[model samples]
Target: MSTVACPDCEARVSLDTPVLNEIVECAECRSELEVLSTDPVVLGRAPEVEEDWGE
Candidate 1:
């Protein structure tokens, strides 16, 4: 497990074998976060999720 700081709340979050481009929810601020890097465990705010309309 690796500890990372949440971008939204700066809260330390623990992740296990985090993969790049994976989305994770912050437990502190409840913000969606994306795993940018796994080497050092870097997190960034995830992009807004939009509903897809049936084409």
Candidate 2:
């Protein structure tokens, strides 16, 4: 298992074979986290999903 610190809460999150662009949730803050990289296991805040009005 790989451990990485949550960018929002600074809590340790364990990942099992995490991949790039994978979305994960933080247990402490419950914020969505995105996998920026996998080599060193870097994590960042996930972008909020917005709906398009067929524009």
Q: Rate residue 27 of model 2 by lDDT.
A: 90
Please provide, for model 1 over 1-55, each residue's C-alpha lDDT reduced to its tens digit, 9 standing for 90 to 100. 8988898888988888899999998888899899998887889988897888965
Worst 10 residues of 1 by lDDT: 46-55
Name model 1 segments beyond 4 Å from true. 51-55
TM-score of each: 0.84, 0.95
lDDT of each: 0.89, 0.95
What lDDT tens digits, residue by residue, belong to model 2 across residues 1-55? Answer: 7999999879999999999999999999999999999998999999999989888
Q: How close is candidate 2 to the true structure, as a TM-score?
A: 0.95
Q: Judged by lDDT against the true structure, how good is candidate 1?
A: 0.89
Note the residue pairs that clash in candidate 2: none
